[model samples]
Target: MKPIVAIVGRPNVGKSTLFNRLLGHRRAMVDDSPGVTRDRNYADISRFDKPFILIDTGGFEPVTEDRLLQQMREQSTMAMEEADVILFMMDARSGLTPADIEVAKMLRRVKKPVFYLVNKVDGDKLEHESAEFYTLGVDRFYTISAEHNRGVLDMVDDLMDTLPDVAEPSDREELTKIAVVGRPNVGKSSLVNRLLGYERVVANPTAGTTRDSVDTLFMCNKKPYLLIDTAGIRRKGKTVEKLEKYSVVDALRSIERADVVLVVLNAEDGVTEQDERIAGYVHEAGKACVFVINKWDALDKDNATFGLYVEKVRMEFKYLAYAPILFVSAKTGQRIGKIIASVDEVMEQYTRRVSTSEVNRIFTEATESHHAPLAHGRRVKFYFATQVGTRPPSFVIFTNQPESVHFSYERYLVNRFREAFGFNGTPLHLMFRGRDKKTLARQAHNPA
Candidate 1:
């Protein structure tokens, strides 16, 4: 497991900017607006092969009657629990406030390492002004600018040096990667926090609260899984910011790397064009998927409501026909437990392999039931079929006339195989190759 390093501070102190700076790119959204970052975003970071998990938390307000600030405080508390070292970022321009003093007192109670980071110190005068933060009772402090990448590397190096040696490798092979993807404000963070059984991430009523792909490692039923919470994927026209465009790219990359993807949908709004586009990307990537219809409790439904909604989903996302759908309310914990089980089931199909003899037998029955389409007045004939790969189960079918196989016939063959063997929740890659007499003879002899 990677050691978690959390960045925590009052709002507008440049925590998100510092997070993006540490990642060596603009991942988190940076704005002058306070409380722009309401959720605790996480990402993997490293310097010179020493890797660790980095988390960017919301502003720390220990005591507040305001509902939003209370929720933000809960998010920060959870981050403190998950962190191995906490970086307490302060604004040198604004000096220290009562909120900063309260945060320092809170950190002092916990028997953990906390580093005082005075941010926005762009020059000597600002660095000199940063001395006011020493009154918070932390002996060590670093003056830096997150936007300009000043003194950030040295702080990380020193933080890593202070951590106890972890013998495990940074990359663990026996782990399943699950990515939660959807449009903005579709309860992706809320779903993640519900599954985690804590306020691990800040969830607000605002849209686009999460701007980066945050990864968390956890276990369910003795099986380890990595959950990647990504930013909302918007259409090209709507992605105006340079940061937003990078976030879209990052979300797509997360889908590519995920073993199983939970395509979250807002049940209140039903399926939209943007949702379909996001699902199309998942299908094209050949990733196993689970259609998560969130906010189910808000829907006024009868017995026919589920069927109608499912029909709409199927009609829109026809390419993801094999994917399973589950209705869950992250707010009420309705059917949320089924998510991990569905992921496990899909992983079974994704990594499953079939014998060559079994594959050929199934193909033969399929062709007998539904004949292959003819092309150029010649009948299409399949000689044999074999599975070439596993993890999205790719198969190669050798035929006398590969070009004669029409799209409908190919679909028939895939459907037949899916019915004969359960390929639920995973995509099947079917390829056709034409074989001449010589090649067929060689293949018969080698049986590869």
Candidate 2:
């Protein structure tokens, strides 16, 4: 459960710049593209031993004057409601304007902590010029330069220190979260209602009906389960595209927090490029997944239709070969009941752990079948292996030449480990650690 920190301000106030700067500054990290912050605003930021979500409510330029202030106020208010901590940034070069005063009035109503920041205050001269913004009557404000990295970290340190660190709820461990995601108008919400046996979420025929990811706590056979229903994700060229209005924060956040993801595909559309991108996201996150082909009843299918569809899905999502596929129709109540059982089975595999001796035995047998290839004109030697973690069952293999381990060999070992141990419906991570001292393991994408 990470706290969300949002940067809200008028257009051209360095919100997005600061958002991207904070992403790489101060040891914070995220798996996706951090530098491309044109409209992709939400990212999970892990910095200073504290993990939080950063959202930038920027990009409201080019609008008519009559709508700019109204839109800015709406965006700021919405961000304030969603964010646990708010960073209200202003441009010192442009000085304070009427729009800033209107936003500040709205911030005064918020009970949460709001930090004021004046950007573009590069040197001592600009710092003094920033004094004009004090008329907004803020308790305190810091002047800094987001581009050059001045006073940004000091503000974040104070914000993090002010936020109280609390333990996650004990009951959270009892719920197995499943996030349902797909492109527009894929029957995700309707399918979720069918699973819950009620209309917990509003279901409409139009595309983009659900704006936020809604959660519901349910029980089946005395076991608790949580379902995260999200809106359709936008596929922008080769990357996932999003704007401030159509933010997919909850969709990505649900995937991050869930134990399993339900990648819904429309039966009519088959496997579109957007569906492939959605599956890729789930795979990259290392979560167990199930492909649910919705609207099966609407399709005119014969005896061989299911086989053809399965073959097509296998060809498209070859990376998720370990995942199981289900052809269900929310309209006709077809095969939807099997979803929970499949999730239960996949959950077992996702959290599966293997003993160290068994791990070594598998490695020994795998190496006997196929040997490591020569790299850089040197022979690589494998000494030992051990299981270090689970949730994808990560292992560390000590070897003489970790950097020399071929990528093909890493993939081979992963397949062999999966074949020997029945770790279906989950990815495997095998890190190569060098036997010599002072050589840290540099493996990031080997066999994932």
Candidate 3:
């Protein structure tokens, strides 16, 4: 797992700006508006051949009653708790405020390593003013301008030295593979941070912040699992950068390798066509899938209304009617643990096997319920069925006329299999082949 470096401080201290600078792009939204980034932002950062996860905490405020403000505070506090090293940013131009001191006090209590970054120290005058922040008892301080990209590389170098080396798991075969995917800026990385108990990727407000496929491994309940954070998928015309173009391709490749894919969706936006397209890819790849409704705290829905949203999702993706849907607040770390349990359940289903007798029984009953279509006045005959593989639950069926099998008929059989044995959130593959030589000979000669 990558080391987590969290940027935390009072509002408008250039935390977001520094996050984007270290990430080598304008991923985080940069504006004069205080608390523009109310949610935690993350990105995978590398410097001098060493890599770590960077987190940009939302502006730290001293409010606890307002719901939204409380959510932001929780997100920032979570970042601090999970960080391997905390980058405590402060403004050199405006000097320190009471809020900054309060934040510093909180950081001092935590045993984790902390670095004081005095941002906006553009010239000698601002550099001289940066000294006042040393009273925060953070010990070391770095003077830099995040907007101008000055002294950012030095900070990266210093953080890289503090990161602990990641060790490989002993039982690689037992590792549960989970991929975090969604449309741009839906807190995919933020969710990843919660799962790994730290920030292993950088989160930003701007769309397409993550441009690489980052993998982090950790254990939940003594079972090791790998979490892959991927770039957001956008429509064809929306992508511009060469790096981003490759990143999208890499994200699809990660989906192919994943055992369970968590489709993260923004609760405020609801489901869209692009989301359906992404869901289609997971189904086509024959992988177990789960729907994660992120940022649920932002949605002003009561208990009854939230239930309706889940029902609507099931209606939209009828193919995955059996797949589980989890509503979570990545910002507040709400129900984040449930996401891991859901992935584990789906993975169990993916690797499950059925006996030959059970397979034949289900196939016979399904075929008897609705016979295969007639081909040239001859009814298609489906013979014995047997399990051939797992990790997608593949099967082979011998038939009198394999060519006569229709795609719709295959779908019906898959649905029947789901009904008999719970293959929730998992895709199934069925292969049809002729049992007799004459039937095979005819198909080979016709070449249709």
lDDT of 2 by residue, 1-448 (tens): 5687888877667776787687874211122222212221456677555777777663333234644344444545556787899888888988988868877887899998899999988999999989888899888998989888999889888987976685656675467889999987899989988999975555767677565565566799778888888767866652244431343655777788789899999999889998998899899998899999999999998999999999999999988988999999999899999999999988888888887778878898888778899888877878678778877788999888888888889989988888888877788888997765333232221222
lDDT of 3 at 109: 86
Tens-digit lDDT track of model 1 for 1-448: 6788889988899999999888888767777778767777777776545677888987877778978878877878889998888888999899988988988889998788888899999999998878888887777899989888888889878886877666775665588999999999999999999999976666778787676677778899978998989889988999997767877997998899899999999999999999999999999999999999999999999999999999999999999988999999999999999999999999999989988878888998988888877788888877878889977999998898876789998888888888888986689999999878688667755666
RMSD of each: 3.6, 9.2, 9.3
Best by TM-score: 1
Candidate 3 versus the native: TM-score? 0.61
Better of 2 and 3 by TM-score: 3
Query: Which scores higher on TM-score, 1 or 3?
Result: 1
Which residue pairs does candidate 1 place in steric collision? none
Best by lDDT: 1
| lDDT, candidate 3, at 106 | 81
What's the candidate order when arranged by decreasing TM-score? Answer: 1, 3, 2
